[model samples]
Target: MRPAVFFDRDGVLNEDDGYAFEPSKIRWIKGAPEAVRAVNQSGYLAFVVTNQSGIARGFYGEHQVHALHEWMAAQLADVGARIDEFAYCPHHPEGTVTEYRQTCSCRKPQPGMINELSKRHSVDIHRSIMIGDKQSDLEAASAAGVTGHMFRGPDLKEFVAPLLKQLPRIR
Candidate 1:
């Protein structure tokens, strides 16, 4: 099984522009692309797991989120980096959209997304790591049996480079 790196999209990969669902609003965090490339070279699968409560809140639709992600992927491709897959939860308990108003397991601090991804990708949870800028992110990672790192930085590559060195390399 391959170990993976789970990234919290908003605060970790890009600036959280409050319900940002447009490519124009995306401002990637410093070294975000390089950090991802490092993971790619380290033989770790890179995945994005995020919560998009804005969908439930009616601020945007799933199409917008998907389009934004596609745009983001193309941006990363420009730097020779690629995210294997993207997973996001649109459910919110208190929401304007009736279809997505109920609480679901896929949300952050819930571990549902991580658990599902681990199962589907055949991930070695023990060696997997999660990096996020929130307590909830760590909580979710713990629940899923993966190590979690808190990031407070202006440069992602600086924070990630050393951490990548410690993980067991996969063929």
Candidate 2:
């Protein structure tokens, strides 16, 4: 089983440009690519887990979100950091869009996505890590039985290096 660096896309990978659904508006957080590459080099898979309630709110569609994610993946590939998987929750309990309005476990703070990924990828939940800029990220990791890191402030790249060096050396 492989360990993974589960990331939250909006604040950790890119600036939260409020319901960012377009590639043209994507803004990579400084050092985000390098941080992802670090995870790759450490032999850990990199995955993205996000919540896009905007779709449920009728601001966009699932296809649009996927397109932006595809562009994000392309950008990461350019930096030699490939995402092993990407998961998102498009449901909102009170969503404006009828089709997307529903309770879902895949949303952050529920661990649904992580649990599914754990089964599919055979991931070492304890050794795995989750990085995000929100409390839900931390809660999800905890619920999934993995360590979590909260990215604070503007530049997170500066912090990744030191943290990477300190990750309990895996045998």
Give the best candidate by TM-score: 1
lDDT of the structure predicted as candidate 2: 0.87
Tens-place lDDT digits, model 1, residues 116-158: 9999999999999999999989999999999999988799999
Alpha carbon lDDT of each predicted model: 0.94, 0.87
Poorest lDDT segment (10 consecutive residues) of candidate 2: 162-171
Q: Give the C-alpha miss distance for residue 124 in model 1, angstroms.
A: 0.8
- Superposition error at 4 for model 2 (Å): 0.7
Clashing pairs in 2: none
Model 2 agreement with the true structure over 1-171: per-residue lDDT tens digits:
888889999989999879999888888888898888888888888899999999999999999988888888888889898889889999999999998899989988889988898889999897888888999999999999988999984666686777777766555
Model 1: lDDT of residue 74: 97
Residue-level lDDT for 14 in candidate 1: 97
Best candidate, lDDT: 1
lDDT of 2 at 154: 69
